[model samples]
Structure formats: structure tokens, C-alpha cells
Target: MPTAPCLQTILALVPRKRAFAASNCRHASLTGGTTIIQAGQIAWVRSACPAGSGPCIFRVLPLHRDGFSIPVTDTPAGNRGARRGSGGITLDDVARLAGVSAITVSRALNTPERVSPDTREKVRLAVEHTGYVPNLLAGGLASNRSRLVAALVPTIAGPVFLETIEALTDALARRGYQLMLGQSGYGESREDALIDAIVGRRPDGIVLTGIMRSEGGRRRLLASGIPVVETWDLTPTPVDMLVGFSHEQVGEVAARFLMDKGYRRPAVVTGDDHRAIQRRTGFERAFAERGIHGVPVFTVPAPTTLGSGREALRALRLAHPELDVLACSSDVLAHGAIVEAHAEGLSVPRDIAVMGFGDLAFARDAHPAITTVRIDGTGIGRQAAAFIADRAEGRAFGQKVVDIGFSLVERASA
Candidate 1:
């Protein structure tokens, strides 16, 4: 489809600077000249608030972009025994309060295994009591590597993506990368914003659920120089690495299966996803070869539910009562179609045949076990992990199109 656009050339936008500095400047002006807090650093200056005779109350203002707060106090500049350190309790103070050395406390917090269990527990309790928060920004700046891998998914409400996400998380964890997830919610602008926010953090790697992205987002991603992995949909040229099967192939295969089974009038139940639409296009093209016209297609909103399946079937029956076969975009939808057929007093495969994509865990567990196409999600995951590993380690990775073929798991449904 459209030659699957160039992976790198498609997304080459320039990277924008992190917005924290500008945000901090605005915050400083608004809060008077009491303190200058930016990034992870906080400095105390003379209080600009009105002078009062009694002890002046300290004001805490949260710096939105920097992710730290500014603390202001009205204590006299040279007062006796006045607190003159940073706002929060320091790690040394926590260690002292716990009656342990700073190194032991650090070890306890970062690597508890090396320290005694008793000492670790004592240090943890002291830390909680002292309300000490680790300065992650300072640590990240020092290392220049956040060790955070940002992942952007179309939506988390859909189950079709859960397997890939779980696999990605586990795979990155094995490589010492923590996944920071963001939901794009099927909006291009939202995806762009999320990408900008994620790239600003300078994550070690970025994983996208789909290959499609806005031009600006693509450019920023390319400029970030982070390892990128696109999954769940296939393209000839990938931005970095591709791990998915073709939706068009899935549609053609299903149509052929239905034709071979001698179903004259076949209808389809599809979701609104771009990949699903592609499958629908392929299905229609394949069905046209059999001289089928007005082949009764029903579409439902994305993140498809069983109710949509049931409604699609009911709609099809009203329009084309003779429609004997139905192909669904997902097994979840197929299950709903089967339930709807039963509700209408029709026996599956005998009175009405059904087929579905995604032979998920529940595909075989239904009353009339659903016949579906099986794609090895776990295998795709492993392949994606291998691709990322090879790139990250500077190894030669060849063979771009890895078609871990699909199989038709025939059952009682069709």
C-alpha cells in the first residue's frame, strides 16, 4: 500500500529543545526573587515577600516543567541557628538519623542485596520518616542516559496490543531499560505531542506500536538518535526495525478460505483501525474475483467490543438475510457474532459460518470454538527484541522482511 513509505525519510523532523528552562524562568518571575529553582537545582535568595516581624511562612511553588518545587523562607540572613541548607532533608541526614554510614544508606536504597536485611529495613524506615526524594534529574544529567525507554501505543484499552506491550516491557527490562508508556489515543496530533515530550526526555530507546506518524514527529524521532522499533503492522521500509504481518495478506487469505468453503454470500465485520481498513480493502478486492457485489460489510468503532460484533451481525441479517458467512477482524468480535447468531436461533457453521483473525487465548475456548488465523505474537516479540539488540550492539542485521507466516486454525465455526 503506497509502497509502505520510507521508514527514515518519512519522519525526518528537527529536534526541539527541552521546554523546562523557559518554564522555570516564567515560574521564577511569578514567584518574586525568593529562590531560583531549575532542573534539579534549588537556590535560596533574599525573600521578596512583604517583611513581617514574626517568623515568615515558607512558600512552596511547584515548577511544572522542571518537576521540582521552590521553597522560600523569611528567616533573617544572619540569624542564629537558622536552617541554611537545601529545602529537603539530605541523604546524609537520613543516614545519620538511621545511625548508618552514608555509603551503607546509598547501598541500601540502590542495591539492597549487598547490605544486611536488617540494616536495609532500618535505612528504608529512616528515609520514609525524613521524606527524602532522590534527585533523578541530577542523576540523569550526570549519566546523559536516562535508562528509560519510552513506548507509544495507539491505545491501551484494546487487547490486540497487550501481548506486544508485555513482551516489549520484558525484553527492555532484560537490557536494563525501564519502559515509560504513553497512550496516544488514536489521534495524530496527540501522538506528535507525546513523541515530542518523550524525545525531550532523551530515552535510551523508543518503541512505536505502528509505523504511521506525523512528519514533524518523525523528524524529531530521527534527530533524537535513539533506537526505534515499530511493531504490530508491517512496511517494506521501516524507520528502524519492523515486527508485524501484513493486514492485506490476512484479508486475502480469509476471503480465499471463505470462497473455498463454497460460501456464496460472505459479509465482514471490521473495526475502524487503519490496518483493519486495509484488510477490508484486500477482502473486497479478493471477493470481487468471485463476482460478489454489495457484499454487505459492517464497520464498528475501534477497540472493538463483543457488542459491536453482535450489532454487526444483526445489521447484516436485516440487510442481507442470505449472508451465510461472516469474517471478523478479531476473535473478540467473532465471539460476539457467534453469540448474536445463537440469539437469533441460528447454529454456527450449520446455519451461519464465521471466521476471525487473531487466534487469541479465548478463540478455542468458545462453545463452538472459533476458526481463526493464527499469528505468533510472541515470536514477533522475540524477533523485535533481536532486531533492537542487534542495532544497539552495532551488529549487522540483514533481511528486513521477516514473514513469520500465519496459519488458519480451523475449528467448528468455519
Candidate 2:
């Protein structure tokens, strides 16, 4: 049996009563002149003091047979050192475990092609054993590239933006980049806070669902010097690159389509969100231009649900019984309206025509297929990704604002 090395100084000091419990030693109490307590690979050695001199001092040290002492540094009380990486395992720990330099560990993990196969394998096994995860933020700081793109949307519960989100995620992934999604809610207040947080992290790019409405939010994004792509809703003055269509145009076109189909007394059931309001404005303006005024509008809270849609149509019918056509902000709302219309024993298109925005999946497969304004969500996502990638890589992209327009798909519901 190998004898334990003599402890010179205390690395960590604990009260006499708590010392054994803290060190998790096998020994019950300090005995004789010296007491050695073995706990796993660590050994605690207690040196007895004079009767009333003081408490016996316990020095903790790792038990090594080869006499090669690993340097131990004193950490703050109750703190187990700074955990900059996963599971308190640092690059140095992995390197030491692999019997290589810290730089070699980094090179093996990051640029594996530069490291020899044997060295890489050694580092891999050591990393696996230690459960070490590289700190991407630290690595990003050195490289000045996080390889991360952040995207902010109103809400995730609604399927209207699903296509755009999916396409954006796929596109970013293909370009060796990851996306961090944030929900801005349906109001500008939440969006401003999210923008501030995202800017502080300094991601490679930002994809905004709509053009920045707040001047402070816009300024922060601009000052951050990050690549930005605004999508879904269009404006002449964007924060940076823009990929969207005019919501106003969508509403105006829908109005014209309804007029062409000989439906007078048109009404709108829209959410109070900014984009939805813009669509309502455009719809009202188009009707007003054709000498038609006061197109009855019923407003619903944002993230409009099927229940809200049912309630909206019922309220509108009660308020304006003569209204012949109803335009909804989303397909979800339109589907609810159709259901409610059926509940009231009204035939769609014969009794009242319904039009929806966002040509969602269920819109085409409904009882009476919905006629809707189809915005190219996939195109918006792909274009936004391209813009971000181009700007991030310092490549020149010509068009800053690309309006991939919307189309009105005529179906049985209209």
C-alpha cells in the first residue's frame, strides 16, 4: 500500500465538526497525532494541535501514487470555480485529461482537419469522458462570428407564419448558421425589449417579421451594425434589407375581387394587430374610392383564434344583418366564420361570401374551399435568409427591398 503524501498547507479550511462531513471522509474523528481520511481519489490529512491551542487543521490533497502533484488553486468559499463551459469542465481540463496542450484541444475540436487522427481521437475520448462542451460565445468573440441568426415573430401559436419560420430555419441551417427565435407578441412594446436583448448578444443577423415601428428599436438595430432582414409586411423605409409584400395591396385587391363578383355591402372581420390594421385601412380605402363608404369593420384581438372568428361573425351579423361579404384577417378566422355561418343555416357564397388572408393548408381543404390572398411566405423566408447570409459574409447583394407580391386564389368560399 502506498503511503499518503504529507500535506503542507490547507487548500480549504472547515470547522472541526463539519470538516469530515464536508470532505465526505470515512474517518469518524481525528485520532493520534495525524489522521488520514480517504474519500474517493482525494485524501484529507488532519494534524492534531495542542490541547487548547486551536482546532486541528485538515489539508485536502488528491491521492497520486506516481508522486506527480497536480496544482490546486484556492477558490472562493461556496463557489466551485467559474463554470464557463458545460458541467464545470473547461478546455484546460479536457486538454489535461487528454495529455495535450489547451490549444491542441481547441484545434482538435474546432479545426479537426489540422489535427492528426490520433490526437483528435484522444481529445474526443477525453471530451466524452469529461462531458465537456465548448463555449461557443467565447469562441465567437475571438472569431467575431457567432454563426447565429435571430428571428422575431409576433406569435408561434398561429400557423400563419409557420411557412416563413420553417423556410428561414432550413435556409440558415444550410449556410452553417443557427437561428434563435424570439416571440415579440402582437404589440410593439414586447418587440422593442426583444430587439434590445438580441442586439446585446450581437448575432450575425436578425430577421424581423415586420418593419420596425419604434424609432428607438430601429436605432438600436442600426447602431449594432448587424445584418437585418425585415419580412412579411413591406415599407419603403426598412431598417436594412426588406423581403415582403404590401398588406395594403392585399386588402385593396381583395376589395376589388369582391366588387367584381357583384358583392356589395362588404364588411371586414380583422384583428387589431398593426399589420391587420394596415390591411383593413387598405380595404376601407379601396371601397371608399369606388363611392362606397362605411364598410362595417369588426375588430378582434390579435393572434385571432377560431373561437374569436366565430364570435366576430356572430357579432357582425347581429350588428349588420344586410352585410353580404366578410373578409377575414386570417384563414383560422375565416374557417370559424364558415362554421358559424353553417350553424346559422346559411349557405356560403349563396347567402354570404367569405374571403380569408394567408392561404393556410386548411383553407384549401375546408367544407367550401376558402378564397384567400396568398402571400409567398416561403419566398419571403428564403429571400430574408439570402439577404442575411450575403450581408454576414460581406458579399454585395443588389436589391435591398424585394416585394414578392401576393395572389388572390379564387375558391368556392368566395
Candidate 3:
């Protein structure tokens, strides 16, 4: 039987009817090959013809006239994660195990604010044993400010931003901030619009996943006077305060690392982002500085996931199997390359050393932990928050640029 490609799956499921035509809908490219639509019509979904065997699905979640929206149900939380029931275990079971009422267990899990410290501690122990995840949306809205901080990542299903996001949420909550998450998915225009809507609702502070912005977006952010922090990428001229290392530096360091490892023929697998472009430029310049010529490159669109990484490896192998090392823009792509290497029966590092950018969870977890340039995304968030908090209190902050350095992490892959 023929396999159902991703494009086919999206095309089949998109609601082509007129009722679902507005662009307020959001799309997130998740890990494990699932795309979540945030309550909108299914606009135009199409698949670009593959240059070779790998297939790609391109969908336009038009926020304006072109793309459509689809209705999205309020997805539940916990281990199930918007999935249907898994009958084996549940919160109620954990509550029973802990000798606490289900309501108390829920209170322990969702809002320890109202519960007694002793009860909260008991529920916590039960949660540890039974693995019960509280439904965040469950229990009617109690407080006026949900303490929710809505962060707009380019994509959550993709993994590059997870560490940063986790750190951000944790840091915010430590200071009594809750998180409401959204994914922009390479949609700058849509992201701009999302920012507008998010700001209108008045989130405590807005954390942008990337630095690049549309002109109108720049203006609105400047005028909003809210504590806005831009992470993941840095700029000399920032909208407010910035906390990120330079992408150009990542590229330069990767090139230098490859050269130090005694590899001459270097190729890059990169996502289409301004920062990634900087890295590529830095890498190329470093290569030229070392008297190496003809740097090979393979480019893919952003929110670089494992799938795209696999495809990039295939393309590079076809064109330059002799290439000594492959540098990827993100860890997701590097992990993909590792998987593809196994599929093709090639040994990593021996056949072609692989290097990825983000030192994400999978970067270390993957077979032959991927060597990468590690950015302190958590540090960025913490510092950004500190700056925002200070600025909000009418305290002065002079330095706009915070250079959180990147370190080259050594592992089996490189």
C-alpha cells in the first residue's frame, strides 16, 4: 500500500467550506508530525513538488483575506496532551493513591494557592507516584489575572524553543507569572497580528521567540510601552531590551570547530531565517579565512524539525557525500541527520561528522550526543525578565544588548 504523505493528510483534513474562511486561525508544526490549528478555516493547503523523494506540505493560514480558519476545541492537558482518554491511569487514581479528595488533588495540582500547605505537599507526593497532570483550563476561572503570560513561539511542535520556553515559564511563575502559549510558524504577518491581539489583552510582558519583525510591528511594540523582550536572536538596535547571542557567531564557531576537527569539506543545512543566514555568512567567511573555497549549502524553511534535517542530509549526500562534516542550523535537523544516517547504513562522525546549533534535550539524548553550539536561552529569558521588571518599576537600564555567549559542546556526533 502507498503511504499517505503529509501534504495529502493536510489536504484531506482541511475544511474547504466557506464557514471556515477567516484567517484568525493559527497553525503550529508540532513534533511527532502533528499540526494544530487554532480555531480557523482551512485556507489553501498545497504541497510543493519534491526535487527528489522527500515531500513537503506548505499551508497558508491566512490571517487576512487569503487563508481560512478552522474551529479548535479546548485541548486538555497532562500526559494525554489533547489526546483522547488513556484508561490505564488518571488524576482520580492519583487522588485515591494519595488519600485525598479528587477536588483536593485538583486543588493541589492546579492551584496550590487555595490549598493548605500540608494538603499541597500530600498531593505533590501522589502526583509524583501516579504521574497525574492537572487540567489547566479545568476549574472555573478563579482569579482576575490568570497570572498567564502568553508567549508566541514560531512553533512549539518543533523543539528549538522548548528549553527557552520552559525556562521563561518557570522564571515568570517564580515571580508569579503564568503562561499562555501560541505558535507563529514562520508567519511574520500573522505573528504581527497575533502580537497585536496579545498586546491588546495586556499580557504582563510579551516574549518574542525571534528578533526579526515587520515595520508596523516595530512601531506598535515601541509605542506599547509594555515590558517586551526579544529572545533567540540579537540586534544592536533593539525594540526594548535584548537577550540572545549572535547567530553569526554560531556559524563562525561551527566553521572553526569543523576546521579544528580536521575537516575541510564543510556543508551547511540551515533554516531560512535572518539569524541562520548570519550563521551561514559567518561560517563561509571563516572558511574563506582558512583558505578553504567552495562551501556547500542546503537551505530549508524555518521551524527546522527532524524531518527537514533528514531531507537536508539526503540532498547533501546526493550532491557531496564526500563532504566531511554537516553543520545544521538547529538540533532538530542534526537529530534528523542522525536518523537518516542509520537508515542509509552510514556511521555518524565516521562517514560524516554532524554538528547542530541548539543544545536541546534531544541533542544530548540522541545516539552519539550531537556536538553543538549551546546558547543560554534560559539565561536570556531570566535576564530579559529582570530587565523588564526593573524597567517597569521606573528603574534605569542602560545597555540594550546583552550578549549571552555560545559554547561548543563536544559529543560523539562531531
Candidate 4:
């Protein structure tokens, strides 16, 4: 005998027909791997039964659509999310456990303001007993505000953005808001997928690490109606508000710092990030303004590590041994460069002056202590939090754009 085909293959074997007569609407139970495609009630129900279990009949609730709907393989939450007998925990389960009505449980959890103190206590205990986590996506319909804020960062590998993140988390928590963090990496493409998920969560506000560069990402943010705060990069036209420094200004200042130190042969060791590149651009432009040309630049993968910084210096040395200044995109990279310089028997500042960005904790601790560009990362975070909270609370800010500005920390390295 031929092997049994999967339900998907079986469904493909059936002929498409329109509007079965009421008598012909015979019930058919579906088991795991069993799927049926029917007109009018175009629901793709999945059996909770273990795979290869025998077929069992199920009665589906009425599904109505005014017109053609895109084929749905999964049921929408609004239709089945509240169904009491689906085995998943529902409001009814909590109510039954708490010896209260379903409405009471909902009121206790979502609108505690309207529920009695004693009833709220009972619902809370029941929820804790059942280990039930409310589906915030469903509960969002009643509350309108999820009381959640989302923060997007390029990477969390290094401490480059730790100050800002810590501040944002604490600030939001103080305002009765929770922070939902998403790492988009250094690539713009990763942001699109993250934005889609964040928008679906219906967060009260969104805090982004850098300004959104992609058109699709910006459009989705604008459509979300959530307050947005773009941090760490300056832009006049933001999705909502901006609290950051000018990467261009940082780069120019980095160049000027090295130049003032009497170092003319400068090279920048940078990660391939949008803001880092902007800083590099500014650095080179400053050089060009002083009739200096072709400043050497080495770019490594973003959220750069010490190893990449070491490799960058070696590569730069091979190309230009006369290169004197190493402008690193991050403190970790700067630390790497300093180590590599010592290994190469080059004296810091005398042979190769190292400069770093972010002014991370380790920057000052390194031997010869790195000179770096310091931005008030925590300040930016606090201000961004304020902007988001105020916007969520329907309060207007005095300024929609904030340029926290950057500082060049003069240390022993340069």
C-alpha cells in the first residue's frame, strides 16, 4: 500500500467548491497533520493531538467575512483567544480558580481601578496560582496603552551604550513603564523586522539607539503612533523626537584634537556603523579643510571588539607605517590599539597616539589612558525617557530636538 500523505497533501487532493449546503456541511474531525481547506469558513485548524494520532471530529465556531480574506493558516487571536475550552489558560480559567466571574478577573487585572480591593487581591492570587501570564496583546484592546516602552540598540556586545540603556531602563521603570529591548545590530535590515514586532506589541513609546535610516523603518514608526525618541545621533527631521550628539561634529573634533597635538599622519580605525562612518567623514573633512588629503581609514565589523582593533592597526601599519594617530570608533577598539602598539614596541603618544570614542569605563583604566570623545550617554537616555514619558502622557516638550553635544577628553594617550 502507498504511504499515507500529510494532511497538507491530502487537502491539495480535494477539489475546490463554493458554499456547501447546510445538510452537506458534515462534521469532520481533524487530527495532527490533518488540515482542510473549505470555502466560506476558511479556517486552518490545527489539532492539539499528538502527531500521527487518529482523526477526531471537532465543531468549529462560526467564522464570517464580508468578502474574500487572505488564506489564514492560523486563527486570529480576537476570534479564539477568549475561547474557554481551548485548553490554554483564559480569563475563565482564572475566574474559576479564583471563584469569581470572568469579567471580575479582567477587571482585577486590567482595570484594577474599577475593582474592589478584596476582589483584586483574590484575582491576583488566582493568577499567581495558575502561573498565568496575561496576553498583553489581547489586553491592549481594553487598556489602549500597554504601559511598555521599547528600546532598540544596534548591539549589546560592548559597554559602548551601557550608560544610556541603564538610564533608560531605570527612568522608564520609575514612570510606571517597562522597557522592551530589541537589538537590531549595526545593519539597517535587522531594524525592519524588529520594528514590525515592536509595533505589534503596541508599546506606549519607542526609544531607538540611532536615527532610523531606512525608509520602510521610518514609515512603520510613523504609522505606529507610538512616541519615539531617537538617541545618539542628531537629525533635524526625526520620526518623533531626537536626543543625541552630532556624529559629524564628533569626527571633526577628533581630527582637530589629533591635529592640535602636532600629529599630521592620522588614521581612523572604525566599525562599519552609520554613526561611526559619519564621525570618520567629519574627521577626514577637517583634515581636508586644512589641505590634508587621503586620511587612512580601516573599517571592521560593528560593535567592534579589541581583536578587531588590533587587526585594524596591523593592517593600517602595513599600508602606512608613518600613520601616527589611531582614531578608534570605540573605547574597546582603542584599548586594542594601545595593546598592539606596545606589542609592536611603539611608544604611546610618541609613535602612535590613540584616540577612542564613547569614553567607556575601560578607556581611562588602560595603560597610558586613552584620549576619547565623551558624549553624555546617560544624559541622553534620561532626556529621551522624559520625552517618551511626556509624549505618552500627552504632554508637549519644550524642544523636540536635543543635541547633547560631544566632548574631547584629553588624556595621556594623545
lDDT winner = 2
Residues 199-259 of candidate 1: C-alpha lDDT, one tens digit per residue: 8888777778777557787788788887887877888767766778888888888898889
RMSD of each: 15.1, 8.0, 20.9, 12.7
TM-score of 2: 0.76
**Residue 81 of model 3, lDDT score:** 48
Q: Which segments of model 2 are wrong by more than 4 Å?
A: 1-87, 92-130
Candidates ranked, most accurate by lDDT first: 2, 4, 1, 3
Q: Go through the candidates in order and give each one's C-alpha lDDT.
A: 0.72, 0.80, 0.70, 0.77
lDDT of 4 at 181: 89
Which has the higher TM-score value, candidate number 3 or candidate number 4? 4
- Of models 2 and 4, which has the larger TM-score? 2
Candidate 3 lowest-lDDT run of ten: 4-13
**Sorted by TM-score, highest first, which candidate order results?**
2, 4, 1, 3
Please give the lDDT score at residue 189 for candidate 3. 85
Q: Give one digit per residue, the lDDT tens place, for model 4 in 68-179.
A: 2111122222344323333344566568657799888987876688988999998997676445678877776776878899999987877878899999889888887788
lDDT of 3 by residue, 260-323 (tens): 8899998999889777889999999999999997898899998787899899899998988688
User: Tens digit of lDDT per residue, candidate 2, span 251-364?
Assistant: 999999999999889989999998999999999999999999999988999899999888988999999999899999999999999999999999998999999999999999
Error of 3 at 230 (Å): 0.9
Question: CA lDDT of 247 in candidate 1?
Answer: 83
TM-score of each: 0.69, 0.76, 0.63, 0.71
Selected candidate, larger TM-score, 1 vs 4: 4
* lDDT measured at residue 212 in model 3 versus the true structure, 0 to 100: 47
